[model samples]
Target: MTSPASPYVGRFAPSPSGPLHLGSVVAALASWLDARAHGGRWLVRMEDVDGPRTVPGADQVILAQLAALGMTSDDDVIYQSSRHAVYEAALARLTAMGLIYPCGCTRREIADSAPIHAVSGERPYPGTCRTGLQPGRGPRAWRVRMPAGVHCFEDRWLGRQCQDVAREVGDIVLRRADGQWAYQLAVVIDDADQGVTDIVRGADLLSSTARQQVLGQTLGLPLPRVMHVPLIVDTDGRKLSKQNGAPAVDTQAPLVALQAAWTALGFAPLPDASTAAAFLTQATDAWRLRWHIHPCSA
Candidate 1:
């Protein structure tokens, strides 16, 4: 007899710096719906990794909001702060494989070293610290050596896309100079260790998926399939975000928020589906039918 399949597991990892706004709600809803549709386990990762950026009581607020929205995650929340040992272990593995190195170059120094790429929206590191500074150097920030050649992937929502990691992203940081964990490192370790099967989030993270896939391959971690839905933007055409002051959705009216999210994703609203669970059921079916429907980005 064939072995039983690994159950589908998806997650909505939100940084607990503030309340869940429209865009966040959209992400949680999509991930939850996707997991439900596939009879999968949906988990939540409280990304309190960046302690400096975390707001007080934000974690509780986020959980309460998700509960109010009727988004039931499978396990008790997994906080990133508690997983440093796991991240350290992964980093050690990469170090053993000679995939990571210390970098002394600061942001200002990098900017001064090379012409920053304006298109990537972030200054691409110029490998100033790729080579070691003398032999017996002490601990400094760590950088992952991105593999060369074209890294390509078929996005579940955005079709065949490719990028040269060496050119586009350059060497990404695994650990920051300030001793905090980088998002790239933390997220990859968490997903792999947690056995996350799939990732469902907003389109804004589309490009980052490629980098995560590359990291996964290097570290021999299972690469989860990604589903990037369009972001919820304000009237200003800006994606609703905490930085933009997007108010958190009222958890009291979860069905209303769910319906709005479904409609935003181009799903036709059900006529009499009035409850949150019912809307989720209908929305998931609609979403599954539209899975891997890539956006035309020519």
Candidate 2:
């Protein structure tokens, strides 16, 4: 167990592209439970950097759903849209370090340039603009120059993990051509700014951890301990996501929805709890026990 004096901040960051689904609930519950178990502060961050995708009232809807589930942020909710200046400062710092450059390649250009052996399914940016932009091609986005080497970290659930960002992820975009802050850069800056010490989310984001870790290292920010729970997928084995048409969880019957999320996390449903508050208390207790028994303390 973490000492009371030790800082154990955790966060549940969700995009306002849609309402909270079962997948989102699972992630929220896990982060909430972890914060409770460790006697830490839990926060909610609205990842609405891409303004075009944000639904008008989705942030309030998401907050209401979490409240119905007996989970609330320890502090005021932070929206990514309001933090562009902070992100720009971080970008400026990186730019000053000569770690960033203008990217002139379009999606089609990268796809056409990628070699056949790119098994990662992502069209790795072939460093076409690493040296200088191609003639007549203006800058489309800003990309960070990834250094060559294996970046490794220990996941609380998945254990030891490693990835070569330079080879696999390539020069990732810091800002998209559309003038929106890319997720990779914004999330790193936000987590650090909010003093988030732990990140508990779905396994689908596991691949992104290494890239964020590298970016954090470059920015001299403290890396948060991470735990990626198994994703709740659909019948087709696809992870439930707004993009996949996963329906929003019922806020009106939040306790029942929480039960489903608990079950999805491999825990037996709490039969003794009647209300959302009682259920969350029981769930937090169960999680504390599991955390003590788990091999990775962080």
Candidate 3:
């Protein structure tokens, strides 16, 4: 049977490791624009999965920034740290399906493995723990066993992509060696739980989309539309990040920042578009036109 009708639900899930920098502002603004333009309800989720990394009061500051920029979500904010039970349930489901197993490979162990694959131009897991050791071992992490075969999906922007998760991703950790839940596991569960119909974010995360799609299938959740817009970079051409020390937006100049964001996507903003609503309307038309000219190759 075909999937249910896609809901008009969109979301912006950001981590609270630090303030919402310029790159984050672009992502938030873009998600907000697309949701509002379609008359959809946008929701905000605080991805505080790594408790050790999150800063106190960062979530409130992020929410405040959205409000100051005139981007309002439809529901109360969801914090990942507060949803441990939900993650436990999902982990139980995967465990029951025999898709999850204990992984004892550390970073050093993985790096020393013979066969490996590179992701995002860095270290890819070598599947050292895929089929190793007993289940109840001490201080082991949980990994989702990836199935063999080519997995593919058509991104709304990046076009058709195919990857063999078993080969490329290997057995990825669901729970960390440090007892922290992995991002891949948490994100898949959160998206399904939130009823997210679409995901729009920076191009930097494009590589993870394929693995997420596989996780969605295993969890019996609909594969949402994926769109990865251009990521903002620093003078050195490095992607702006919290570690890069990128400054957060002033919120008072959201319109200007929004304009820059649209421009980075290779779209032109309207001259008189001062308000958030007005800028979003123009951004929508620009996106449609761009997609029309260069449709997704999927």
Number of the top-ranking candidate, with TM-score as the measure: 2
TM-score of each prediction = 0.90, 0.95, 0.90
The better-scoring model by lDDT among 1 and 3 is 1
Task: List candidate 2 segments past 4 Å from native.
Answer: 1-6, 116-119, 293-298
lDDT of 2 by residue, 185-256 (tens): 999999888888889999989989998999998988888988999899999999899999999999899789
Q: lDDT values of the candidates?
A: 0.81, 0.89, 0.78
TM-score of 2: 0.95
lDDT tens digits, residues 1-298, model 3? 1132454677999999877877887888777766655556799999999999899998888888888777777998999998889888999999999888777766777777734455435456666656766465554688888778888877777798788777776767789767689889889889888888878899888888878888879888877787788899999999999888888877778788777766777776679787877777777666556555222311
Error of 1 at 229 (Å): 1.0
For residues 181-250, write the lDDT of model 1, one tens digit per residue.
Answer: 9988888888887888788899998868777889988988888877788999889999999999999888
* Candidate 2 Cα deviation (angstroms), residue 98: 0.9
Per-residue lDDT, model 3, residue 171, is 68
Q: Is candidate 1 or candidate 2 better by TM-score?
A: 2
Determine which window of 10 residues in candidate 2 has minimal summed lDDT: 115-124
